[model samples]
Target: MSTAIASPRAFKADAAFLRGLGRAFAGALIFALPMLMTMEMWQLGFYMDPLRLALLLALTVPTLVGLSRFGGLRPTARLRDDVADALVVLLVAALAAAVTLYIFGILTPGMSAREIIGKIVLQTVPGSFGAMLARSQLGGEPEGEREKDPPTYWGELFLMGAGALFLSFNMAPTEEMVLIAYKMSAWQSAALALVSLGLMHAFVYTLNFRGGSARPDHIPAWSLFARFTLVGYAIVLGVSLFSLWVFGRTDGDSLKEILSASIVLGFPGAIGAASARLLL
Candidate 1:
């Protein structure tokens, strides 16, 4: 028991590998998304051009291999954890990336705060939920079992509040969903995903590592998941809202748009669910 608990992350578990994995997942989404949307499963001349995606995936391949070599970090997500966490991460990551771009736009003076956030959430929401459903369907587990283990309700309420507020306040003017399928540059979309993934994983792993690698340890407070959930969600939401209110409000954007647009960027987390999976 001591050995299991005390085991240190070995080989490829280092920061470089971690960063690379984050980047790969992000880049793959960017590369595959446009083509997938345009061409579907079949590759076509205009949409299915695979050069950049192939390159991006290739860039991370070595890192993925190295990371997996440590202990098979390949996505055993289904058996190990429900797909909700990933979706949550995906949504949060997208928002994070959007926020990054938002800051960038402040300096460049072209993109609207609302437009960027809206576009990001629009494309990201579907991908986030779709990824969840995709993994769940592929996972082949009974919905009943998954449903049976519903997360502690307190955590859910707080997180939902936090997530909703985060989304509504920070990402202003509500970006148009149309941007997801159109308008974004290849590099832009990939950058969006990559940065967001990095932010999400950093938040998660920091908590996990701080918590003694035990799911229970990761809880906000024993029998107080809601309290902690509210706090964590609150911090993130506050930062996002503040970021938008300051930088996002400069233009002719409507106040309603800014407020409505700020939502928790990722999937409303499965707090306890993530905790359980991290432990298992």
Candidate 2:
């Protein structure tokens, strides 16, 4: 009798899981499509340093796990569940990359195993982020899942970092990042940095975007700027540097060159960080 009662429940659970997988795949493809199709990305795939790539994949796991805690496709109530979702999101990312690349003629059986694996691994970081965010962006969660509690200050910082990483990662492989850096004068770079910081602050506290946190009346504006905007931009800068390094953009570059490129990437990264609550 118990088995009979459990059969329908099991079927329902399986169905829901399958649906979650579908959402994950959709998210992965949508988020990773640009990188998958870019020629530079393809070249970097086979040529990128193995150690750096490995570190990227390793870091991605924790990032995905953290994202799962806040916005997993399933309503996770425990650390184990978050980990499981991270793994599942990775699987979804891989499958999405493999299928899309195959259809695009980028992945062929004739290609070396190393090449194929490298391409997929590189794409997986962004893809997994998309999968983890599918619930929030695509809007299908299993029944009875409550909204996530408000994030603490650190939690907010993590979200900003994740957002910054996602946006910066998308652009890091492109040649334009370096070209723009080269074209700019030192004064121009300084102006751009100030502009980035100003826009980020505006987006977070001044612009009044729907999901933006309302600054309490008693909390002075400068305090909020120092506490969130400055810190978030710092995180964005770190993410930008890491993304550039992952793509070998910093190989043999001088400190001035590296900082210039980082500031260029940090414009979008800062925007991503400021709007994380809206996006992720």
Candidate 3:
């Protein structure tokens, strides 16, 4: 009788795990589909500097840890649980990337092991992020439960960075980002800087977006500007620079050129930072 009782319980647990895995794949596909289809991404996967790719993958771990703490696909109560969730999601992302790339004929028996691994690793970055973001994007858990575990101030900032990175990744690989930056005059760059800052502040604090709880009326203007807006823009700029560097757009560029590119990319990055709460 006890064995019979345990069997049903075990079966139910197995079913739940499978369901979560399915959600993970769906989320990975939803977030990574565009890059999967992009030809530049496929080429970059094989040729991007291995050291840079490794560093980027290293950075992903902490990002995943932060996302797990606040908005993981599964509720995690302990540090180990969070780590486990991240690893599981990473595995799911790797599998999904391999299957999708193979189906699209991007990966084949003709490729060497190093080339195959690089392709999968490059794709896994976005796929794993999508897996981590599955809970917020694809829906899981109750609102009350989520609210009970509200992200800390640092976690909020981290989420802004993640969202900025995700939104900018698609554009970072395109030649147009560099072309646009090269064409802009210094004054135009300055104007863009102002616009980016203003839009980020407005979108986060003033626009009253659905997911954001920031209230200008309740918070002092000085505090709002200093605390959220400035900090958010800082995150955007950081993400912009990092994205450019990862995509090789910063190669051979002087300091002035790099700064110009960052400022140009900062427009989209700032918007992403501001709308992180809604997107993530």
Candidate 4:
């Protein structure tokens, strides 16, 4: 006699298991990505200037701890959620390039002080809302599905945005900010801003990853002490390149200056973000 096919309930169970496995895979990639970006920042800086690289390492501790405490809430959290935060940090690095380039007409002839002020105010609300909308859309879960958390959404956003923005800006002034602050043209500022944000995002993401679930056999090449070095480097390279292109600079000197600014620029966002992440 032929055996009976698996029942509907069995099929449903199998399909559910497969979906979970898919989610886990996606989550792992997302979780691992931030660490990759962070590694790139540290590696590139170390390759260029090891002493200053210490500062980047130093910044990671706080970011990881803070993220553990204050990052956006997820259903399972499961490291994948952490990855989303890190990616957004990376995206902000790209936005800095846009800001520096005046892609939104920031530096145009009509951008008087009043206009700038008005624009900043006008954009802040919408910009924040846009970010929230993006986050909500990315969640993909129905509104009813999200878990309940303490009511501190705005506070966390403020900390995340402020910390990332300040740190990145400090890492390297946008060529324009550098120019205006130190007298340089818009294009140059764009380049500087891109590198700075890229480094900052990389640094923070790594810090977040450091807090990731530690596995017993993460590496065997360095006898299990490698800490995802090559993977991290790969991430940083993309993070840096994405921002660098956004900044619009290909010059060796410009890139050098931007790299050097990483540690110094990372301070504020590091502190503020860490603090905010912790408190939130």
Against the unseen true structure, what C-alpha lDDT does each candidate score? 0.35, 0.88, 0.84, 0.37
Q: Which model, 1 or 3, shows the larger TM-score?
A: 3
lDDT digits (tens) for residues 1-280 of candidate 2: 5575569877897788899999999899888888888998888889999899999999999998888877778778899989999999999998898788788888887889999999888888788999888877896554235568888999999999998987888899999999999999999999999999999999988888977888899999999999999999999999999999989999999899999999999999999998998888
Question: What's the CA error at residue 223 for candidate 1, in Å?
Answer: 21
Q: Candidate 3 on 16-71: residue-level lDDT in tens?
A: 77888888888888888998998877888888898988998888888888788877
Best by lDDT: 2
Which model, 1 or 3, shows the larger lDDT? 3
Candidate 1 to native Cα RMSD, angstroms: 16.8
**Candidate 1 structure quality by residue, lDDT tens digits, 1-280:** 4444444554334453455335534543543354224312211111222353334223333322222221122244343232334433355445544454345342134645544433444334323322332322233344344432333545334333333332332232233322231445556544543444344334444465532223455555433433443344444445444433432332355543333322223222223222322321
Residue 258 lDDT, candidate 1, scale 0-100: 38
Cα lDDT for residue 61, candidate 3 = 84
Q: Which ten residues in a row have the lowest lDDT in candidate 1?
A: 39-48
Quick one: best TM-score, which candidate?
2
Determine which window of 10 residues in candidate 3 has minimal summed lDDT.
140-149
lDDT value for model 3: 0.84
Write the residue-wise lDDT of candidate 4 on 189-234 in tens digits: 4564455444434443435543222334543435312233222223
Candidate order by TM-score, decreasing, is 2, 3, 4, 1
